[model samples]
Target: MTLNRRQAIAATAALFAAARAATPRGAFAQSPTTPEVRKAVLGYIALTDAAPLIIAKEKGIFAKYGLPDVEVSKQASWGATRDNIVLGGERGGIDGAHILSPLPYLIHTGRVTQNNQPVPMVLLARLNTNGQAISVAEKHKPLGARLDASPLRRAMNRESKFAMTFRGGTHDLWIRYWLAAGGIDPDGDVQTIVVPPPQMVANMKVNTMDAFCVGEPWNDQLVNQRIGYSALVTGELWRDHPEKALGMRADWVERHPRATEALTAAVIEAQRWCDADANKPEMCSIIGRRAWFNVPVPDILPRSQGNIDYGDGRRVENFPLRMKFWRDHASYPFPSHDLWFLTEDIRWGVLPSNTDAKALIAQVNREGIWRAAAERAGVPASEMPSGPSRGRETFFDGKVFDPEDPAAYLASLTIKKLAGA
Candidate 1:
């Protein structure tokens, strides 16, 4: 008889218990490597994408790998997450985080750090893909700006505020892409503001923002409070687009290579658990608790299971583009996806045109680490992606981004604030 995913996971858990019993005091269960340290601190923002790290902690997956002192601290904002990451765990900050995918690249390059001081960092794995949406304030409900944002073009101006969590993060990129596709200039057509994920709904409630882009459950919360309605999910902009990541301070990872692998293994296992259909409700409940997100489970569970309530008279069940935590190699950090993000950053003048994206990607992206951790996590060989490069990706507006030719992709875009312009 073929064992299902849950049963296989159960068997893996049994092996972990047996291995722990047989191993010496310092060694990790189900693996030959022993961690150099037993403790590490990680930070997270209160978004559904951060579920993997939370689950890893709540399920004791970290302790299973000999790191019993892993701490998943809550961060007030992405900027706070970056500042703390720069401080490092030894300095009372954190060692790693459930961070924006491009943030590690930006922080590693010193593009967003204090005084442009480069903080070396490493990208271990992608936490999830999709599950983010662009929301319109209820005032714009009559505009009917669905997937196509053209309807709001006339209403938008420099005075109109559009908020995202960070200047160069995934939320910024998604909102920019959506606006640009609709023939609205993101750089000049409106004012783009930065608001924390949890504050999105409250800001919209006070009429401070015309529209915003963020991960759940804020978007859902806004809809629930009847403050705003979703115009489009980020997946609608680009299906299965890369989002948050497991990023660590490079020095920390270097000092504790085995510990890094073990931490990654734990997160990988958690991602697998989060993706299972049977476990989403429990996962949401765990993360939504007062100590974690302080959010209602209803705000999180529906989207986690692929049900999208657009709150604009467009509700869909089992939407194909709902977030993927582990399915389709979502846990693997693909270098090609990073290239697109870098290219988009370049288009918006976040990174210089002369920036060597490939060199930086090679230095920062650690897919090799992901492979080792997945193997240790007991991920089936069939589930492992054949290789990097998810290939050419098409957007909802009919634009194609070929990862191999980033310049060509940039050249195709009509609205852009290219670096040095």
Candidate 2:
């Protein structure tokens, strides 16, 4: 007699537990060649961008690399995820994390939302690029974008409000930059507040926030719910922009050197799996399932499969770099990424004025670790250097960012950083 799905799931969970116990310490369950060496925990929120880690775990990339006991906990938010690692919620302290691109800077300088004691962290690899955007309420439709060249000045006069997760986030940074570029002051012109991504649409429906910036599916969620429209995609803001990364404490890397290399190998392979068009359907189910993403499968499948519903009578398929994670030297963890975030922190006054930006970045980034991982994971090692890198990223205004000369980039800006130099 065949059992039902629930019984099958229970049986699978039991098998996993039994296999785990039966295996000797440091022994991988199935792959005989790769013995289990160690286990590590990572924290991530439920967003499409977290796919690489999720897929990697589901696909047994972790087991392939000898990490039989790996656990990927879906935390509620970025702040909670960060705090979990900093406060040592993970076993034997957190080894690494799936975090924002600017997080390493925030941890180092103690700026932005975390204007406290510095939490030391480092970059291990880049997860993906161009996966976030700004969505505006439909009520503000005829006024162009309130975020464009200071739309808030006139809108605020009309009492419009904006929303994002909180201070020290990608949304806050992008909104501030967009507003300042549009000749508006981020802090003064528009009323901005914090709301969790999951509740963004509900809040907007209740007329709480006029606009919000969040990662995909949520932005897509807003559009689907008819509450908001896309003002900009991160790709439009900065074509192929870097968004998230695999982060860790500098001390954690120092403690377990080999584990870092293996961990990266598994993740890189997982990233490749997610990128494969054939695997998308399976990936969607993995992300949407209760054990993982826990989002509705209907909401999870389309975007995860690259068919996005833009909500405003626009259905876009195959948007170029529609979150091209782990593509074309994406996992290198470039020094330029660090510099850009550091500059933003200074520009936004998240840190005290005149923090040694480059110096602190160098200390946190385990260049040696990244180099080893890249070589092992088949990423081009030559592209990443020991010093500052000169890289140009395309953005919305059809401009390119040359990290070697951020001052020129800043000067060319029509908008200004609120934490001005």
Off by over 4 Å in 1: 1-32
* Cα lDDT, model 1, residue 143: 92
lDDT string for model 2 (76-142, tens) is 7677766776765344445567787777677655553344777677777788877777888888766
Kindly give the number of clashing pairs for every candidate: 0, 6
Off-target runs (Cα >4 Å) in candidate 2 are 1-37, 90-94, 112-115, 146-153, 157-159, 378-390, 398-400, 417-421
Question: Model 2: clashing residue pairs?
Answer: 28-36, 112-350, 149-182, 150-182, 180-415, 181-415
RMSD for all candidates, in order, please.
8.9, 10.2
- Model 1, range 285-316, lDDT digits (tens) per residue? 99999999999999999988888888889898
lDDT for 263 in candidate 1 is 95
At residue 156, give the lDDT of candidate 2.
62
